[model samples]
Target chain A: MALDRKIAYINLSTGEIRKGDIPLEWRKKFIGGRGLDAYLLYTNNPPGIDAFDPENRVLISAGIVVGALASASARTHIMSKSPLTNFLGSANMGGWFAPEMRWAGFDHLVISGKAEKPVYLWIHNGEIEIRDAKNIWGENIYDTQTILRQELNDNEIQTLCIGPAGENLVRFANVMTGRKNAGGRTGMGAVLGSKNLKAVVCRGTMDIKIKYPEEALKYNEELINQIISSKVSQTMQRWGTMFIYGTTNSTGLVRTRNFQLNQLVGGSDIECENLDKVSIGLDGCFGCQVHCRHRYVIKDGPYAGTYAQGPEYTSQGAFGAEVGCNNMNTILVGNHLVNSYGLDTLETGSMMAWAMELYEKGILTDRDTDGLRLEWGDDEAVLELIKKIATREGIGDILADGPLRAAKKIGKGSETYLVHVKGMSNLHSDERPTPSLALGIATASRGSDHLRSRPAIDLYNLPVQVLEKVYRQPDGYDGPLTSGYTKYEGKPRIVLWQELCYMAVDCTGMCKYHTVFLSPNHPNFPEFAKMIYYNTGLEFTPKEIWDIANRCYTIERLFNIREGLTRKDDWLVDRYFDEPTKRGLPVAYNKKMDRKKFKAMIDEYYSLHKWDNDGVPTPELLKDLDIADLYPEESRQERKGK
Target chain B: MKIKKVMEGARDGEIRCLACFTRFRPKRGVDRAACPSCGVQWRISWPYPKTARLQGPVWETYPKPGEPIAKK
Candidate 1:
């Protein structure tokens, strides 16, 4: 009834394994998945440890509600020190792997120490074994899955693996499962590769015993009915995330040529209609009713034999519009190539787009690119460069490290075009249009991530009463497009509410698309509390959930504070605050944020969270959350050796 | 786990290989077969699945999944 789950702590260097019950105290404070992961990673790893060091830990956590009857509950969180940012790094993915791990009787798997050689972990039922991966060491994700399925003789086995990009230490490498699900941010795969770990294959058939099963089922039925009837879910189920392409382009959110332009020239060619040309059918995650993934087949274009599961709106923004490529089929190809190599699509495309801009400006040459023409919309060049980057071949060695690192290596004002925050490449969204979106990216712990706190509903231009009621602000601010009320009053509250909701949703294993991400009418805090209550029999109010989320976020803030990030780190790139969008209508173009107002907004945000003016969680607030033990004053004194 | 078809009634149709993205007309029905070009095995059958010229998996939208074959 209390959710019986164990955590597996495996030391790869010593070939040792440890198992223990999750501390109830920790569970009460940091629910599970991303929340618990942040707590464990911050506590287990000190501030100045190298991301590649043997002491750096990797954590895989199944969500608190994973494997339950709830739709899209089959999600997992991956956490480690990111090689890209050298700070607290985390990502989440949806697939069957988390459910398999849940069935295997573990909610968290903590891995430490680098193995002597390449190795893979095999978990069957409750048994864990470390096995040699000599034969599958250099394989791609798809091939590795095929081989492991054959060798294990269990086609049903679920796997989480890294590909050659990770094995080669591409700083933006991602961990992948099934054919399409990827924990694709902050370089979790590179950490796995640094530990000489190849894959974790698991199979389990045990039943998950939960409290109030009937109540959970009833909630699931209600949610399914609601999700099916919702207009946003209906659109998502049909067009996946690509449904937003036209709107994003119209609103000056479709980033092109490394954020130099926010609108694509040939819009219709990169819209969902173009994606529809290749989308053969729909595919859903483990139990997702929205079915936002599309199974695409390239039957007629230059990339006519490509097949893959997605090209989510991110792919459209990354490969299609951003690279100046008008053909959606090429975007599908780029998606397939990136997935095969287990690279982060956003980072890869951003890097390529950055390099193309440099080449176009004569900052980089053919000699620098290993004689390959680095031009915009060159699909063949894009394909070849992807391979080179994955294998770290030729000039690809520099690009493999991501745009930030590559810019430093080729520093002749190339850093001027570097579209990143805190050494991580920017997402496809153009945040300059909205202060809330811009601030969200600036303060996200993982750096330059939108999922951390993108208040997707703020873009809907909802009625002020609805906004005021949901965000609890005094008034509905003027829309994000206007630089009036949104910049002054309500943005801080919107971002704060969004971050907590997203953190809770991530921990609870619910897809944000099913929540208030797309619209104000979707599920919210009370509904989440109800779901948790029915599933785990844990009596929690919406306020308690918000408190736990605050504690989790505070832990992350403490981690980043110790790593030397300050209020100065909580700002956007100069392009957003300096240069205006190159071309668009007068109302939507030549837009730049007021840096003074942004700073004031940050102050308000910090004050609301009881954080100091410097964005540090205060001792009084930590004590209020009962987590002061995590960051005693002596820790800072000890850092100074005083 | 792989899909376990009850096999109440087998129908003849074209099927595409997810592995190789090849579409072919199987001499024996589309329930299970191998791609002629890429040699990848496929067991999932679609509802009247058709490819662009059957040369290879080009960029084209095939028919949507049938109601019975849609659920996983």
Candidate 2:
């Protein structure tokens, strides 16, 4: 079984649908899922198209091992040119939607052209239909899903939909499913909005015939057991990803009050243990064991009656700490509002916090915000802003364009207040003190993002032996690896290693929690190779997996390069370098990211990728990866009409 | 995610490192306990509000997973 899943090309303007089996060469080269998606997007999209242009294609794909008996193989990846960053717009989310899509006889979807009217795609056992979504237009995320379920009469179907934030074309708006699961960064939802497409409904009874069912079951059980055995998994199982706040906050490694502070002062209200007051237990996506998502109910407050699924550590950083709110209710309520409206919690919170800072500095006056005081921890103002941004009402309309665009419109040196990389907001976790994590976010293809390659375990100060073992992949780099979180020595190698490992993990559609994200002892290339081979009867060595990951990540880099990103764009903001951290552990306290060392680290990182100092992939490297023709001189000239 | 603070070390209770989650017995008047797993020295406030807070890591003593703990 070579996993020849079907990729569908749907044109909304002309009501035409095309389906075909993905070529085996592409499958072997790209490894399906996000890997395939990168290839599809890079090949299908011509450069210079506006993000909202009808030709800007949107792709949704599932990883190779998704339908197989695999560990946490329930992620779906979506990609298009970002309205916010205007570079490579890609987002991955954990949910059963991808698995349902696999069972519905497709692994990838290429949606092109805008519909004349609002509509949704309904895919059943081997059938695709374009259904009118006139009745559900402008519905919020929760309402849209509920309406689709009512119409389809299927409780088990999965729906990926957008809300008013997306329909209004909020630059950082996102797609949401299962209440909390969001393809949450880089404005994937706005792409759907531009197309007049509302939702993608999937339900099917098609069997996913495995090549070696018994061996796959045996190996998958072992893999699951190993995954559940990690201490990180134990903590995540109990407290969800909220547990990350424990060490990060105590160590003072978070972006507080819009990057004004290193740590949240008096922040126990948002600690992981405090979630117990609101949430009784956690939930999981399809076939996931770690269950790192919280479904909480607001116990008491104006928002007490509402319930929603997550306020992951991001929400805590977004609504709780970053906005200067020290109450759990504000975090829960804010989380609910963002999810309901299908907005990205990270970008939304970052925008709100940045605006609060601007208002505090007299940059945003009472006239701009309609006389509402943008005070810290003002629950009403915070909740009201979520509504405003989603509806594009008043000040929210300006903020909805995302920080970079909004900054371009407002010129009081306000752009300096933003804590973003490559025009996209970073996570709530401040990385000024952590060089590896800082480099990870600064160089992510989809702009400032953590999940793409954050070597989170680097903060754990694991032994250099462990670091050496982890960084020994993709290439046998016997360099000096350091476990110190603040050190720049060997950071380039670690970040590069994690990038490829993550690319492979994403290629397999496995959850990051199941891999060595938070835990150094979790699965890696060897385990992934075994998982794919045992499940699909596709023979692959760990080296092959690394090469495929390299190929995939390098192609992503190529995509961004073609979109006009240069070496200068592969760095963080001035605040990350200019302002020293005010609070944290002794090592991190009063520490600013050293520009010279970071520059050298970037140079070394480029060398590892065989990319030149300017961050261009060298011809030799491109030839080695067999992607030399991906962005040929002829294609570049053709685009320029030279 | 559990926080075990022996702040007022007034009555002896199980103390734990907020970083590595290692549970230990409160040492009499010992105001500090270094974690066996992550090796972060936590200040044990033996006051009205019992507290065991580990602020940073002692990297040299930090061990890899399943390795024997080096504790104080």
TM-score per candidate, in order?
0.87, 0.91
Candidate 2 on A1-642: residue-level lDDT in tens?
447568899999999999988887887798888888998899999787999999999999889889679979999999999999999999989989999999898899999999999999999987889999999998888899988999999999999999988899999999987899999999999999999999999997777878888888888888887777565676677677877776787667889889888777567677766777778678998888778888788887777768788878899899977888888888889899999888999999999999999999999989999987888888789989999999999899999999898998877999999999999998989888899999999898889999988999998777888887777864677777897788998898888888888899998998988988988878999999998887778788899999999999988998898888888999989999899878655556777899999998899989988997778787788888898998676754543453
After superposing candidate 1, which stretches have Cα over 4 Å from the reference? Answer: A300-303, A473-488, A636-642, B1-72
Error of 2 at A337 (Å): 0.4
Residue pairs in collision within model 2: B7-B45, B7-B47, B7-B50, B7-B51, B8-B46, B8-B47, B8-B50, B9-B46
Per-residue CA lDDT of model 2 for B1-72, tens digit only, reads: 122222233323445464444576556555556756656655443322223323223434433223433444
Instruction: Give me the iRMSD of candidate 2, please.
Output: 13.9
Q: Candidate 2, which segments miss by more than 4 Å at Cα?
A: A1-4, A634-642, B1-72
With candidate 2 superimposed using the best TM-score fit, by how many Å does residue A74's alpha carbon deviate from the native?
0.3
True contacts kept of 2: 0.03
DockQ of each: 0.02, 0.07
Candidate 1 lDDT, B1-72, residue by residue in tens: 122121121322444343233445675433445567655333332222221111111122221111111211
